[model samples]
Target: MDEWLKAGLDYVPRWIDYQVQHFAQPGCAIAVAHQGEVVLEAAFGTADLSTGEALTPRHRFRVASHSKTFTAAGILKLKERGLLRLDDGVGNFVPGLHPDIASVTVQQLLSHSGGLVRDGADAGQFTNHRPFLSTAELKADLVLAPPYGAAERFKYSNHGYGLLGLIIEAVTGEPYTTWIMREIVRAAGLTETAADIGLMTGGTLARGHSTRLPLGRRLVIPGDNLTNDVASATGFVSTAGDLVRFFSQLSPMSEAGLLSPLSRRDMTRGHWPDSESVLDRSYGLGIISGTLKGWDWFGHSGSFPGTLSRTAVFPAQGLAISVLTNAIDGPAQLWVDGIAQILKAFHAGGAPHEEVADWVGRWWMLWGAVDLVPIGGKVFASPTALTPPLAEMSEIQVTGRDAGKVIRASGFFSPGEAVARLRDGRGEVSEIRLGGTRLVSQSAFADELVARYQGFSKDRA
Candidate 1:
């Protein structure tokens, strides 16, 4: 394991333990992939409090709206095959719903701007059914409203994606579940991911749970009395391993391969700024697009009766992280944010290439009594023993076993040879050597090197 990652893994359990005590959660699971490698996979606590079954990587959990990305991918596949255009109206597929709804297009549904009311009124009808929903049957509950804001502005609609499910059925002449399974799920090699709420398939699927009822939320699953009728809109179950693979196929900006590169790019192109009221996160084809923790991240969150889940993909770094917890509220959200922070610290150094650091802020680090302040492109440190603060013109010498550079008024150092190597983006220090101990640390020499150079830059802002 990378030393920093090892340390992070150690910290994860500590955090998870705190969560279980505070939230009364049964258990939590986390998976992280970096450079296409599974760096961290762990389960904390029990899967079932009553039986004392421990959680495992193979446990399945209902990912709630995380299913939207899959449904969106199926729609994109239909578009890829030239069967439909995203701009095509809903009236083009299901002829049964309000014919006036023709104005709402596939693109609008994927972007959640179609202004279709949620399936709130007759949702109980589907909940009582065992078979996969037919296109017309699914549309029986939807109601249409005027476009929310000139079309393509963010207004999240589960009903809008339900319409896309209808379109998928129309284009393939197959059930929505069948089409998604054969086309996107199978092709993506996600043998463990599926929408088969009726059949209870997907061998590694985690059992969905809920805090609302001690018996857990009842849903329609195949071969078992358990299944939730919310399939098309929010009824898919997956393991973190499968979700990691699912995200691996897409770019940071949007879905690709499932749709034409042009369409994929277009879908990811933010149609609405995140600042708009009621829509703080913009939509992209089958993905959510936003900047988080100084990285361009895209993905969605999911929630169900007993499960809350989230997955984030940092495309620029070719990394993806996901967390699933089978309690109403658990440590999953914190785990997601912590993973992002760990990645930020890991890749803190090196000159910017494809990514800009305009959003990365200064971070604090301490090695024994040496206090490091990362600001304006430099890591500045001062000794308490110094008679007075080093004057602005004072030449601060760099010291260490290795020959490193010195900041005129700041005691930051960059190994003279390592700096040139990092400048070329070839050499990256993966561990920190501190106090004669090679202890694993998040802030290594690279971060300090980057800040040191920035401190000497002509502009300090």
Candidate 2:
């Protein structure tokens, strides 16, 4: 691995752990893969808050709508075998569909342009109010005329993928889960993934949790419900490690993968713009794609009842990342983006040199914490609250072992100022001074605040 990448990975877990603690999230698991090999797999917080079970990289998450990517790959795999075609009409193999839906092509459903209902009238199945739709229930929803004609616009429909599952069954003469697991899951060299909850045999599945609001406390949600027929759409259970491994193979640059380079290209192409979304995202076959920081990323996000997860593959960087959280309001999206930002910063700054290697720690002030990160040959005073922590950071040029000068910073910050470290009688650095501001370790700062304002509570009362 490049030294810059190593530096970024070294700090990723620390940042993620701080975020989890600061936000009081249930738990999160993250995995990163480069050049088709996993380089980092870490987890923070707890699997079950009630039991205080520690979360680990081995824990599986619902992964939810990420199943769509797997299903899309399965469909393309069938095409490779000459078993079916993407342009085939749905009714060609699976009978008993509404006239309008029957005429929709397979490609339409894969790209979510079939204009089918997102979920049937009652989406309670997603909120745990009812079980996921069975084949009969899903087919009944398709029996009704679609709200829009085929290819009118982009419309996401879980029922559409459910119908694709049925089509897979019809063409292969096997159950959706059985065929996908044997052919796709196992074939992709993923031992830590399952098509549905019922098939999960190894590893602990992290229990989901509700938000700590409206009730003032989080409630444990048993996220083991099986998706009977809609398993292809939202029933995958996987670890972050397995997710990154699978998504890495989806890159067209990958030499070893389940699909041909042609299929991978078509699947990741930006087919339809998500006009209704603010994120400038697109959909292709079954893949969700977007661009960030001038880098094109293609992957899928998933939302189960009390879990939210996201994964992205950057082909140009030969890197894939997966972030899975076990809370309804987890910052998986933000953290994934933040991780990317950190990686980009390190790549831009290069590796830390020995001159400033030890000048690394998170220092606190009255407003917030600042991470004194050593990168390249200098140090950056980066705010902890920002998603991209290193953005607009203050650059420090070390002049001595315990002294530096702020050479670059915002106009409001103390640029062209001398930075110094204060040490105690033991000759250990205990505090830092950035011009007029005093910074200290978190524990020291807390103690100082308590000592200085201990009587304020009583006076206010």
Candidate 3:
């Protein structure tokens, strides 16, 4: 790895720790792949909060909606084999009675442009109010009129995908889960992935945590509610590592992968804008394509009850990253973006500017130590829990001898505080204080505290 890459990799663990600890998440897992190899894998916090079980990398998460990507691949695989075409109408093979729903082409279903109902009107199963739909229930839901006409606009439909699973069964004469596991998943080198909960055996599945409501805590439980035919739509389980590996192969740059270059390009190329509000996001066949940090990327996000996930593949960088969280409101997207930021900063980080040379030091107080670093004349607070890392030391004009007011600090409650570098008789910095939180030199911290106590005692008398 290049120095920047190495530096970025080294920082990943610390960042994960910071996010899990400070953000009040149950825990999260991450996997990053560069040039087709897994580089960093980590798990932080407890997987099973009730039992206080620490999460491990091997734990599986209910990668809901990511199943769409796999199912889409199966459809494409069939197309490649000349069994079906993207333009084939759903009504032909499945023998459906609804002309409107049947008239929709296969491609539209894959791209979520089929205008099918997203979830049945009674989707209480998702909220655990009722059991998940069976094949018969799914069929009953499919007969309902679509919310809109075909190719009307981008409309996400789990029902659309569940129909595709029926079509897959019609064409292949086998179960959707079995066919996909044999063809798409196993072929892609994922031994840990499964289509639904029942299929998930032998390994530990990451217990899905409940969402922290307005004033509630997240708890661990079974998050995979989608079963039976719906498994093809929103039911899948995977590790962050497997997710990255699978998406990396979807990049056209891969010499040999699950799909042909033509198929990969067709799948990643944006077909329709995701919404009127989103300019950068669009849907391809089973894939969500968007831009990050100005680089085009394509992948999918999974949102189970207690899990949130996001994956992105930057073909230019030959890189893929996946962040999986067992909590209901995991910052998977932000953390994924944060990783990209780290990589970007590492490459941008060069020699420090002259103005920052004097600012480099470890200042301390009773609370903890704060390391001031100047980068290219700009000071940044590193990641810390105690105080905001002085991210940007703006308006650094001196206020007094051996003391200056840091007009800005980065942590909560530390900003706009008077930061003074107190000097000893020898003109050395004895300690520093950001507001009332006195941070002393390491060697002098205890003595400084003792002296302050003694002085306070005398003043009281």
**Model 3: how far is 232 from its true place, Å?**
0.8
* Backbone collisions counted per model: 23, 0, 9
Off by over 4 Å in 1: 1-14, 122-137, 143-153, 202-230, 252-260, 274-280, 349-461
Q: In candidate 3, which residue pairs get closer than 3 Å at backbone N, Cα or C atoms, i.e. clash?
A: 364-439, 364-440, 365-439, 365-440, 380-391, 381-389, 381-390, 381-391, 388-411
Candidate 1 lDDT by residue in tens digits, 1-461: 55445544443444445445555567777787765566777777776665667789877777768888888878877778789988887887877666556677888778776766655445543343443344455566554444453264567766677777777877899877888888888887776676845544645444444453555543222222233334667767787877877776666343535556665566555665556655346677768777764677777788666678888788786778888887665556666766676455435532222222121212223432232222223333332122121112112122432222343532333322221001115543333232222322235445665667767774755
lDDT of each: 0.59, 0.93, 0.79
Q: Which ranking of candidates, highest TM-score first?
A: 2, 3, 1
Give RMSD to native, each candidate: 12.9, 1.2, 6.0
TM-score of each: 0.67, 0.98, 0.81
Worst 10 residues of 3 by lDDT: 386-395
- Among the numbered candidates, top TM-score falls to 2
lDDT, candidate 3, equals 0.79
In terms of lDDT, the poorest run of 10 residues in model 2 is 383-392
Select the stronger candidate by lDDT from 2 and 3.
2
TM-score result, candidate 2: 0.98
